[model samples]
Target: MRILGVDPGSRITGYGVIELADTKPRYVASGCIRTRNDALEQRLAQIYAGLSELIGQHRPEVVAVERVFMSKNADSALKLGQARGAAIVCVANHGLAMEEYAPRQIKQAVTGQGGADKIQVQHMVTAVLGLNATPQEDAADALAAALTYAYSRSGLVAAGSVSSKRKSSSWRHFTP
Candidate 1:
């Protein structure tokens, strides 16, 4: 199955695409949709349009999005929520099944620790996907979200074997 994972932000929304073949996740593409410092409505429209175009191009079987986490700054959180909502609406409009995963859940799935930092997540994602170089921060986060969905669907997360399974250089070698 092809999965599209999203890490939404008001200024820049990241997206990654991966395909699961025989329970192994293969990287397809990843990038960010950066919006100009414009009106809030304009930014939201840009996000929706960008995601819609990406969905059409990729035609993923499912979409996984990171849920908005509470922030100390209410305004920041509200903006993130709006961005996330735009992403969700884009996925829904594409008629694809959508799954929401928390930030901690995504980190745990990728790095075997809920509190893993961005660098750790990036390293793990690169190792699991066998990328030549590390992806950008937001792109790596998006890829982590995709990896989370892949692991969850394969029951590795539920079995509590992500740490062991991720030791492999590639998901192709992941037994679970």
Candidate 2:
């Protein structure tokens, strides 16, 4: 199954795609969507359009996003929520399955600890996915989220299966 993990930010949203098969994860793609320092709504539109294009191109079986965590600045947190809201709208429009994982869950799944720092998480992500080099911080975080989802539900995803929307059925029934 191909899982698209999103790390939404107002200025730079990161996305990573990982295919899980035979209990292993292979990195498909990972990158950041950078938006100009324009108005908040404009930035949101950029995110929405970029994510929509990415979804169309990747056709992921599911999308997993990092749930919001509290920040020192309320305004920053609000902006993050708006950015995530845009991403969620795009995913829902595609009729794709969506899930959220807390930051600690993502870190623990990838690095075996909830309190692992960014560098540790980045190193573990590259090592686990066999990436050629450490991905950018945001991109690494995105990949970590993808790996977390994939590992947590390894039993449900099938390698070389076709992905389709059908009557609610076991994930094993869908070929992704």
Candidate 3:
């Protein structure tokens, strides 16, 4: 399974791709798309187009996006919402499964603590993924989002399989 993770921002939208096989996930690629602040519409268009291209290139099976958190600046939040909406629409239109995680959840998944700071998150991302350094901070966040999805789903699948095997074993014992 290939998961695409996005960290949406008006000025810089970060994205990462990870592929999972045999229950292990590995980072594939990651980067951020930047847009000029002078024109909102243009920036949105750039993000939309760039995202479309990326989708075509990577062909990710799922998309994981970071949910909006409480922001002090209303305008910033609104703009971010727009960018996020673009990503959501792109994923939905493509008939791809989308998952969203909160900032705290992503941080906790990456760092093992919900309140881990940016530096801590960045460091962990680099250390775990063997990323030479943190890819830009936002990019690091995006990678973490992708990894979080991979980790969560991997656990669920393993647990389900284990439960299924146990049920089958108990059923055989009772049948005899």
Model 3 lDDT tens row, 1-176: 99999999888999998898866677789999998765888888888887888899999988889988889999999999999988877776666777788888888777878789889878987887777767888888988888878877877322322111012223323356
Residue-pair clashes, model 1: 0
Q: What clash count goes with each model?
A: 0, 4, 0
**Cα-based lDDT for every prediction:** 0.86, 0.85, 0.80
lDDT order, best first, reads: 1, 2, 3
TM-score of each: 0.89, 0.87, 0.85
Score residue 16 of candidate 1 by CA lDDT. 92
Candidate 2 ranges with C-alpha deviation above 4 Å: 155-176
- When summed lDDT is taken over every stretch of 10 residues in candidate 1, the lowest stretch is 163-172
Q: Better model by TM-score, 1 or 3?
A: 1
User: What digit string (tens of lDDT, one per residue) describes model 2 on residues 85-169?
Assistant: 9998888777788878788878877887888999998999989888888999889999988887787787433332212222233
Best by TM-score: 1
Candidate 3: the clashing residue pairs are none
Q: Can you write out model 1's per-residue Cα lDDT over 1-176, one digit (the tens) per residue?
A: 99899999999999999999978999999999999999988999999999999999999988889989999999999999999988977776676777778898899888888999999999999999999999888889998888888898888687644332221223223246
A best-first ranking of the candidates according to their TM-score comes to: 1, 2, 3
How high is the lDDT of residue 94 in model 1? 70
Quick one: best lDDT, which candidate? 1
TM-score of candidate 3 on Cα atoms, chains taken together:
0.85
TM-score, structure 2 vs. true: 0.87
